[model samples]
Each structure stands twice: as C-alpha cells, then as structure tokens.
Target: MQFTFALFAAAALLTPVYSNEITPMSRRETGIKLESCTTSQQAVVEAAVQRAASLAKAAADAAINGDASIFEDGKVTYNCGNGTTQSDCGGNGVLAYALSGNNKIVNCPSWYKIVPAIDDCGGTDQGLAMVHELSHMNEVYSPPTQDFAYKYNDLVQLPTEQAVLNADTYNLYAGAIDLGCQVGESKGVVLPDWMVTEIMNNNSK
Candidate 1:
C-alpha cells in the first residue's frame, strides 16, 4: 500500500476565472475611488492597487490550471485619502482592496518593500513558489480545515496547534509542496533545504 501511494503521489505532480475585462468604471462598482494627492498619497494608492491585483491574480490562478491570464481585467482600485471610501487608506496610509468574494488583501508599507523587496524570489524551489502561493489562495477561498482554524487561532504564534483543526487540508498543502519540489527535481533543478523547510513550516503552522 505504501509503495502504491508513493506511485500515485508521483503521478499527480505532473498535472496542472470568469472576470469582467470590460466593466466600465468598475472601480466605483468595486468601491475603488482613486484620489489625486501628494506624492506619498499617490504612492500608497498605487501600491495598494498593485497588491490587490496580485491577490486577485493568485485567487484566479488557483482555480485555473495555474494560468494567470484568466484574471486580466481583475484590476484593483484604490481609495485615495479622506477615508470616505471603503478601499481608502487611512490618513495617507497604504490602500486596501477587496475581492468580489469580499476577500481583503492589503498593500504593505513602502519601506518594507524597499528593504528586502517583497517576493524577491529568494531560496530554492522556484517552481514551488507558485504552488506555495496557490496554497495561500486555497486558504482564502476553499480553506481546508487547518487553514480554516488558522483564521480563528493566531497561526503566527502557535503554529503547531493548527494541526488540531483538520489533518486532511494540512496533508493537501504538504502534498502540493512536495509535488512542486519533485517536479523541480525532475527538471534537473535542485531546491535548497531552506526552501523545503519553509514549506514544512507553513504546514506546521
């Protein structure tokens, strides 16, 4: 049985959204109200918009066969200043974006991105990056049991306890990561232990 399961796992690794492209002023519809202001304010809005865009893409990509092109028109709108809009940043703070599914993805501070470069493409398991990120998306939309628990319990502090929620989801995430690493290895790409550690860490949490 163990050998058969391993063979099945090896096979799955090989395997691989309807969004409005032409919704006019969809920004307002989506509650994104952009405002023109100082350099800093504009920068915040732009950053928020971009973050939202990435989140939207990731969510859509998870549903598809990892194809990002499906979410071409899923733009992120920003609420400038004044805080009148739901997407507006507070007092020149970074902007916020909400998905059609009512999911929120925030833009980080400017200084943070500059310091280490968010998504700098570090560590090995480059192919796993997409899989890992997609796991995050799965957490959002079709959250497995553990992920669902993570929402209630602070996963950052007590990562290990999350295993109590549901073992199945945890296994799914782990399997996905392992498959990613295997796929990379098959293509002659070597992944560092650190990258593998990160995947394990995410699951434990």
Candidate 2:
C-alpha cells in the first residue's frame, strides 16, 4: 500500500521547510558494509530489501522520483563484520548504514544469525532495527523528505513519552517511510489511504 499526495498549489503550501538535520547534498560516507548474514538476519534483510525495492519502483511510477526511493536488489550487498563498527543485533552505535555512493543500504549485522537484544518489551523484529537508519539514507539526499519525516515522526510519537523514549533513531526512519508516502499522496501521486494507515500503525508499534 503506497500513498501519494495531489500536486497543487497546496504542494508549496503544505511542503514542510525541513531543518539542517538533513542536507540534500549530504552523504553518509561513514559506516560498514554488510557482506553476509545468517539465516535469521538474511530473512530480515530480504524482507526490508524487497519492500524498499517495491516502494522505490512505486515512487518512480508516480513520478515522484525525488531520489527518495532508489534502492534495488542488485545495487545492495552485505558485510559480515560483527562488533567491528558494522553488525546488527546491537553490536555498535549503528546496526546498518545506508550509504549514498549508490543508494546502498548496508546490513551491518551480517554475522549474527539472530538479533542480540529485544526492546524493553522483548519485541521481535526489533533487533536489527535499521529501519530508522535506512530512512536516513533515503532522506540524506532528499532534504525536504527528511524534514517532513522528522516532523511527522515527532507528531506521531508525541502522545506518549514511552513512544519517544529511545526513539530518536527508530522514529526517524519510520516517519520517513510513512510521511514520505503521505507527502507523495499530497503531491498528486496515486497511493492508497491504507498505506497511510499502515504507516501510522507501524509508527505506533
């Protein structure tokens, strides 16, 4: 389910004036590449990779190709370095890094077969929580999209401190994917409202 906004005078009016957290020319040059992954890690990466590819293709079809969704299967690879600057399963500051060189989203935790730790609630799929970082990758080259996502994320998590707690990273990516679609909808791109609902639902999770 993808959402797109209608392009109109509202576009200029509704478009958010993003902040410095994102710069269109900015590039995330630092981070580790994922060369390999365990069965579990591979599953997670495969799911995210497929979804990302689908979204990227949708964006292109809608003509919103703002460089927000350019990732693909072949363009992506993995690195198995664990506890060495790159690794999911909570081994370092960042589990994965989506580099700007070729719009590659690196799966840092390629070594770990399973996610190391869960959230405070013992949630699954929360281990390699690189969704936020991947969002940053999409926004790194798209400043407006980043600003829009950050603001939307804050709004979504504002209802509870628990939601925002330790949410600095998580919310950003979720917001990017969510609001990116929402913004697209408002820009005249044809997307479904269900997509927006899914994004909202995911953000709450």
Candidate 3:
C-alpha cells in the first residue's frame, strides 16, 4: 500500500494538468451575483477578484502601458446541466471559461461574466471553481494564446490547491498565477515568491 501510494503521488507530480478548468464569459442579462452564489463560490470569486484587482494595477504598471477599464465590467453567471453557454464547457476537466472572441486589448467586451459550475457549488469545489474562473478573467485585457505548460511546467500544481489550473491551452499562465496568489491569500496555501513571479512574468500574454 505504501509503495502504491508513493507511485501514485509521483505520477501525479509528473502529469501536467491538461483540463478540468473554469473561466469567465459574457452576459447580456442579470445573472447570479456574487451575493447570490453559494458560500464557497463567493469565497473563491471574491479572493480571485481581490488578487486580480491587485494584479490589474501592477500588471498594467509592469508593461508601462495598458488599459484603464480592464476587469471593471465584470459579472457572474451559473452554468449547470451538460450544455451551458456557447462552449458547453461543462465537465469534470473542462470546467469553465472567461470567453472572448480574440486576444485583443482595444476591442474588449462590455460584460465579462464570471460563470460558475453549479454542480460543483455549495462546497469547497464551488469556491475553487470561482477562483479558477476569475483567473480566467485576469486575461480580460489580453487573452492568452500560448500554451502555459510549455513555459511554466509546474503550472498545474503551483498556483492553487482548490482546483487544477488547466494548462492545456496555448496560453493561461497569467490566470494560473492569479489563481495561485488568490488561493494563497484566501486559503493560506501560498507558494514561493520566485515560483509566483516566474508564473506571472513568463507567459502572461
């Protein structure tokens, strides 16, 4: 049993997270507010938003050039059943999204909705997913396009403990780092400063 558990742990360490994620999407109508969502959901989203807000300013400052209204027009939505929203993105691994047509700063969308995984609601999973999706929103100004795992190999493990920061996409390092920071701040699951910096600065956008 000991050997078996050790083998599993080692395998888990090597395997990069491919999917089972969350993201934000756009909404036209009044949807689930942060207050209305489950407790776990709220905790996760709030933490993500807090950290994202912090990063928004610092990140923009880092570039020495960015938009002012980034992460300002954000909202929340709850997705259940198999087919929800445009991507149906409702599953165990492919959990959520912060949907946008393209990775452009100027043509930003009006309403960035932080969609939720309802089935995962009412528990720790909800909070985790909320943070995951918010990290997706961190890309509101500049949606990622490069696969983050290629750049930051431990991306799947470093950032958060609640949910896996799906590193399957071509780009998501920023969101993952945001997720990690939020998780650490809110849940006391902090990572090393160097790792956090590497995740944020390497493949942000």
lDDT by residue (163-194, candidate 1, tens digit) is: 32332222233333433433255443343333
- Would you list the rank order by lDDT, best first? 2, 3, 1
| Cα RMSD, each candidate | 12.1, 13.2, 15.0
Where model 2 places Cα greater than 4 Å from the true spot, the runs are 1-34, 38-40, 50-73, 78-93, 109-128, 138-141, 144-205
Q: After superposing candidate 3, which stretches have Cα over 4 Å from the reference?
A: 1-36, 69-92, 101-151, 154-205
Best by lDDT: 2
**What is the lDDT for 14 in model 3?**
14
Model 3 lDDT per residue over 35-135, tens place: 33445544554443433333332323332223333322223333322223334444334444544342111101111233322221112233233333433
Q: Once model 3 is optimally superposed onto the true structure by TM-score, how far is the C-alpha of residue 198 displaced, in angstroms?
A: 12
Q: In angstroms, how far off is 194's CA in candidate 1?
A: 17
Q: Specify the highest-TM-score model's number.
A: 2
Expressed as tens digits, the lDDT of each residue in 1-205 for candidate 2 is: 1233221111111112122232221111112234446656555554443333333333222333233233232333344343344434355544455454565555554323334433222121322243334434432323212222232334344333332222232333232343364534443333233434544554454
Could you tell me every candidate's TM-score relative to the true structure?
0.28, 0.34, 0.33
lDDT against the true structure, each candidate: 0.30, 0.34, 0.30
